[model samples]
Target: MDIKNKVIVITGGGRGLGRAMALELAAKGAQLALADMNREDLDTTIGLCMEQGVIARGYVANVAVEADVEQLFQDVVSDFGALHGLINNAGITRDGLFIKAKDGKVVGKMSLEQWNQVVDVNQTGTFLCTREAACQMIELGNEGCIINISSVSRSGNMGQTNYTATKAAVEAMAVTWAKELARYGIRAASIAPGYIGTEMVMSMKPEALEKIASGIPAKRLGKPEEIARTVSFILENDYVNGRCIEVDGALRI
Candidate 1:
């Protein structure tokens, strides 16, 4: 469907790839409802979208919290009167090896706190937001799409047991939702991005990032805008569902 003037909600729409996707959709003339825990950064993104002459609003919301996510969707429907799409983009990482060892003994390990932190935001958080979005679409009897932001690490990444697990689960959720929600005219899909040159990744040491980029067949970090393009493609093509598109520069793991 044509996305112009359609009301779409985005989680983590404050910074990084989420910001890029918001601006990209704004450029396409879509109305946006953005939710983020960081109010200041969320305002910055909203300002940018307003500059693009698109209808935009931001909510101070924690995607991991069910009440916050519920209110987010409520506000979207209240203000916009309809929902057309949702991007589940809020995520966090607490990277650590499965076991941190010293002198042939385990000194530390991936704590339950660390694991739950990633899973809460990346896994349960996604599930909450997606459920709310799907509920809104189904209740209102509308056709829409849900996009989950996954990672190349979903296949399994060292030092990211928690993150990769959630990502892999996210893709699985998309497939399940696609099949289940298809009857409601709701499509589900995921985008697995490689090392994108976002603010977060760019904060790493240049040499560190260089080594990481060099591993990619593209010889460069993927751009946030590039991932945004895939969102546009998925949104327009109604038949594409239950799939994960890898915008990874051909980088595995």
Candidate 2:
């Protein structure tokens, strides 16, 4: 689709990759409805996008909450009069082994708290947002697309049982949605990113971050803008659907 003037709703658009995509899309003439838990971050993003001469509004929300997700789409429709795209970018990590063992004894394990928290935000949250987006788009007879943010960890990271499951689910779901929602004139796709040089990842100890970078064929981390560019490509290309594109710098992991 021609990106200009399209109304796109991006969850977790306050910072990191979501913010980057919002800024990039805004620059290309898209009106944005950005949702995040942090009002300050949302305000920051809104300010940046507005400076680009685009219509940008910030909605404070938690994607995991069904009520919040419902309100978000309703507000987007009321504000923009149409919904064109949705980026399911809001996610969290609760990394831990499914079962931790010391010596010959199992002294620790992943808590249900950790499991539920990550699943709720990453899995359930994506489901909720996409469902609302589908309903809104179909009811309005709007042709739109959905992007789910997956992770390289979807392949199974050593210490990310909860996160891995959700990421894998994210990648698999786009195919299902694409097949199921094709009749509704909606396309679904996923982007699985490797370690990107984001604020949160860069905050990690240099040694650890470098160790990860060394594993990638690119010999460096990916940039948020790179992922943003992929989003743009997916939007502009009409035939790219029901697929999971890995933006992982050729990293096997």
Candidate 3:
């Protein structure tokens, strides 16, 4: 499970937590295949990883598409010659109440489009990427680790029906994959991150950010590197399988 020289694929590696993870793993001497829809962002991350003296490549793929996910793994293994780890970090959020009513009459509700978009990217994307990555690892006789990026909101956050459902499903999928893939020496796990100081989160109104920090017992937002470090820990510890590591600063939503 040593990360040094291991080849790892990180979906959504163009920015945010995915970028943080790519840097962390690169620092540990891991080869990286970073996938993202933004070619510019992907190139930026690739350059950063390369600066750390590790082999890094960028692939533009939509994790939600079956063909894209399949081709991503194939390309990674072809370039790196082996697949050692996969981090399913590609996800989207379209937060809305499942049902919204006013004065005893329905006003609005989460649209089918919102539900389907999040499900396709967060839940189905994880499934597709993991399946293809596992196939590559098994066929190549490599022991690998798969880490799904879940969320603290998986417990059912207000205004996040679609996101919450997909987050929960990915966590459950990790557990199932751990049990199912053990025979092939591939371990699966998940990390549930709280409100972190990513660019998107930090762009919220100052008051909103303060309110969120006040809710967490830690009295502050999490750093992206904190979750990145947790990823490294799971990949290094062979015994840590089928579990969701919460990096939520003791917050419960």
Candidate 4:
């Protein structure tokens, strides 16, 4: 589980937490396959890794597509000749109340489109990527780790019914994968973050941001590198498997 010179694939590595994790791993001498739908952002991440003297490449991919996930792993193995780990970090949020209310009266329900988009990318995408990673690890007979990015919202949250369900499902799947793949020397784990100061959170109303910060015992939002540090910790700690580590600042949300 030494990260030095290990081959790792990070989905949604274009920006935010994924990019931060990629940078941190690269600093540890890990080779990287950075996958994301945003080519420009992916290139930026690759540039940063290259500057650090790491072997890294970028691939544009939609994690929601099974074929894309399969092909991404294929391309990584073809280029790197081995696979060591994978980070499932691609996700999107389509927030809406399950039952929309206008003046305390039910007006409309969550749109089917919103629900489907969130589930497809957040849930199905994780499944596809994890399946592909597991297959590659087994085929190569290499010990590997898979980290799925989850959220504190998995417990439950207002205006996040779809997101909550998907996050919770993946955490359960992480445990199941650990049990099923332990004999093969593959490990599965998850990181559940709360109120991280990513672009998505930065764009929220100032008052809302302050309110969330107030709720967190830390009294401030988390940084992407904070989460990245935890990822590196998991990568180095071989005994940490099938567990979901919370990166929140004592925030139970």
lDDT of 2 by residue, 197-233 (tens): 9999999999999899998999999999999999999
Model 1: residues with Cα > 4 Å off, grouped in runs: none
Model 3 RMSD in angstroms: 0.8
Candidates in descending lDDT order = 3, 2, 1, 4
- Residue 183 displacement in candidate 2 (angstroms): 1.3
The sequence of per-residue lDDT tens digits that candidate 1 reaches over residues 1-253 is 7999999898999999889999999999999999999999999999999999999999998888889889989999999999999999999999999998899999988999999999999999999999998899989988999999999999999999999999999999999999999999999999999999999889999999999988999999999999999999999999999999999999973
Per model, state how many residue pairs clash. 0, 0, 0, 0
* TM-score: model 2 vs. ground truth: 0.98
Candidate 3 structure quality by residue, lDDT tens digits, 1-253: 9999999999999999999999999999999999999999999999999999999999999989999999889889889999999999999999888899999999999999999999999999999999999999999999999999999999988999999999999999999999999999999999999999999999999999999999999999999999999999999999999999999999973
> Largest lDDT belongs to which candidate?
3
Model 4 Cα shift for residue 25 (angstroms): 0.4
lDDT of 2 at 175: 94
RMSD of each: 1.0, 0.9, 0.8, 1.3
Off by over 4 Å in 4: 102-105
Query: What's model 1's overall lDDT?
Result: 0.93
Residue pairs with clashing backbones, model 1: none
